[model samples]
Target chain A: MKPSSLLAPVLALAPASAMAGSISIDLPRLPVAEYHRPYVAIWIEGAGIQPRTVAVWYDADHRGDPGTKWLSDLRGWWRVAGRNIGTPPSGISGATRAPGHHTIPLPADLKPGAYTLKVEAARETGGRELVSVPFTLPRTGGKGAGNGAGGEIGAVAVTLP
Target chain B: MANFIMFKSLALLVGASALALPMTASAHRQWLLPVATTYSGEDPWASVDAAVSNDLFFPDHFPIQLAQIKVTAPDGTAGAIEHGITARHRSTFDVHLTQPGTWKIGTEGFNVMGSFKVDGVEKRVGRRPGPPPGAMGPGGAPAGTPGGAPGRAPVESVALDAIPANAADLKLTEAISRNEIFVTRGAPTTALFKPSGKGLEFDPLTHPDDLVANEPGKFRFLIDGQPAKGLKLTVIPGGKRYRDAEGGYDVTTDANGVATVKWTGAGMYWMTISATDNKPTTPRATERRMTYTATVEVMAP
Candidate 1:
């Protein structure tokens, strides 16, 4: 019997998070204002609106938790993509992110289907932008690449990886 | 430090020569950041009085652990304001030097560090936050960062909604409502609510609370008899725990519609929900909003 088993409960406190396939969001270079990294929402939309992943490069959750609460701030994604949800579901989440690059993997147990990924960005004193990427994941292997639907507006839907 | 409660009165004198209407009655609310100083000088250990846009009733009711206040002084003493949150709107910071200088407060200046121009100098990295690096050790991976570190959890979902005209309004919504994550294994599941729609301004977590408000206003816990107040709330601008002081707060309303005292440092916490009133133009009474929806509607029928 491995002695490590004795302290499994203590180890259980630190749950292991799944590495969902990451997504790369490219910001548009606006001539006018500075573009702060946006609060991007990636979710599997079905039965109206359901949020699967919230990738806010700039906000926060519990105490020091970081993530996005300003789904509406992502102008383009707000209309059809990142709206309705007020808080995140149990399990995994955090505060927001700063201006730069962010990568998030797809959930292994993600129900395979026509899932949509929504990306929205907003700066406190600057501009707002949104981009949606739609993808279809394989039932078994987490193999896929998100389609790049880059632009600026209220909502832009991109196909799944 | 002394506390201040600003009774915002947004009186917009609009000349409606086109409509020929008598002083148009528009409801308005002034974004009043009533600052108080422990010692008065140019900036004298000043703290920008922040509310969760909602007030918190109990200790567990407040959110927003700490706030990152960045200021660029005229002489250029480049430093960010780190305020320890307390009972929602009742928050205060040491005010560092408390000297006078030009200050521009915003979210995410440069990287995770507080980087602003001080006499044309930049910090380049996040300031030396408190609580040290250990706090994030359990879940300190740069959240939302693609291929983030191991300590943190991966983002499971992200969706956009209700795109606002300007970034500030949208950022406010994100800062208040959508940006929350509850730990299942930890303290019985907490929901950190940032009453304001800005980065870590006022992020406070309520025990076992999964719901929060996007717009500022009054909110009832429903589970408890007390109402969840919406003062202004925030978290450490970045998820950096060291920068945050008390972790959360709420501005509970007393009989005079103000908080009791100022915010001092404490411990870990979540977001706060208070009565965040909308700045209605004229003819509009102080239109109050509740961050969390209640069974009883305040709308006068």
Candidate 2:
């Protein structure tokens, strides 16, 4: 019963359900002269959790662009999930994107249970990648959210027809 | 007569193999000038060759010398100014640019090896896509080159105000250890200069991969840009001097311009600095040079 007492009741039920629930992001495809459509970031976590950054994209003026300098090749989405999205609530204040495919949505006081999805890609002279996906949210009105180890085991699916 | 005594023992064996070599100066060495340390390959009037090797302190290896080849034009009309050069060897470090882009030739002589500088004309070495104040590569077609633009009237930019290039400094103050994974690159990273204060005294220990220790002072270093030399300077510490424990800071310039270097010793030492207008050509010196590079951390005193 000690992972620090299971992290003190999951940090007292994660800031009270950590904002209540919703998410979707599917980007990944490259090849156009080795590839030149990079600069992406998306966030959320809780599976070994500690990441929350919402969004980031770049290509503004293209001078060999490496944005945040290869964004750390996304190392397992920056250590299991962007160090748990440190400061994230909204997303990218500075925008820029071109090569295609991008979709963002996951806000509505997000809270329920299982949630960890992250993606990071950077390129100027080339290369970087990070990916993580998981889901399970139920209980805004209450009921639904199931999956031990707390969320995201598939490409990300939080079914609730 | 025993063939004239074997030709007098082959003339004493060819004068003892010409007195065992040595004395090999043979006129003006090469001078491609990328800050002059020996480089040749920029090609314009085409003819950049220098090799006075074994560093004699670059005064142009005497031998009927007179050299003078300056280019210095980073948007400041000191464009291609060539003058007097004897002791020949494929000659012509020329300079007659009406103007275009990137031109920093700079060379001088008192027999050879005096000045330095390179990276002239429409620059393009390889793989450099965004990593500065402004760089967004993949701009579509600049990959190989061809008539990108050229036809006179684009050569009147010489706003070099002699040397007052925004007082150089590259911050130093330590107290790291939240996780221990720091990084460095060309000190202060404005591409080797500019960090007199806060660009990053601490930003997650600055990690891109950090490894910019641009060798000691590199030599003849820059001033208006860094390690300057006219208003003279020598404050080098924009690198990881072995991760500082208290060892970073060293500036050098004296005779008047008051250049002193320090940082004593400690951890993370990748320190680099330069600023040369420190003049010295025997005609009583004072030509010009400008270098840069910054990385920080020093905490041992």
Give me the candidate number with maximum TM-score.
1
* Interface C-alpha root-mean-square deviation, candidates in order: 16.6, 16.8
Go through the candidates in order and give each one's C-alpha lDDT. 0.31, 0.32
Give the TM-score (vs. native) of candidate 1.
0.26
Task: Kindly report which residue stretches of model 1 are placed more than 4 angstroms away from their true locations once superposed.
Answer: A1-20, A28-35, A47-49, A61-71, A75-100, A139-145, A149-161, B1-301
Interface RMSD (Å) of model 1?
16.6
Q: Individual DockQ of the candidates? A: 0.01, 0.01
Deviation in angstroms for B95 in model 1? 31
Question: What digit string (tens of lDDT, one per residue) describes model 1 on residues B62-100?
Answer: 122234334443344565556555454334443354333
Error of 2 at B111 (Å): 18
Provide the global lDDT of candidate 1 against the true structure. Answer: 0.31
lDDT by residue for model 2 (B74-181), tens: 354455445434332223344533332234343321111121112332221112211211121223212123321223222221212221223123111111111011
What total of clashing residue pairs does each candidate reach? 147, 102
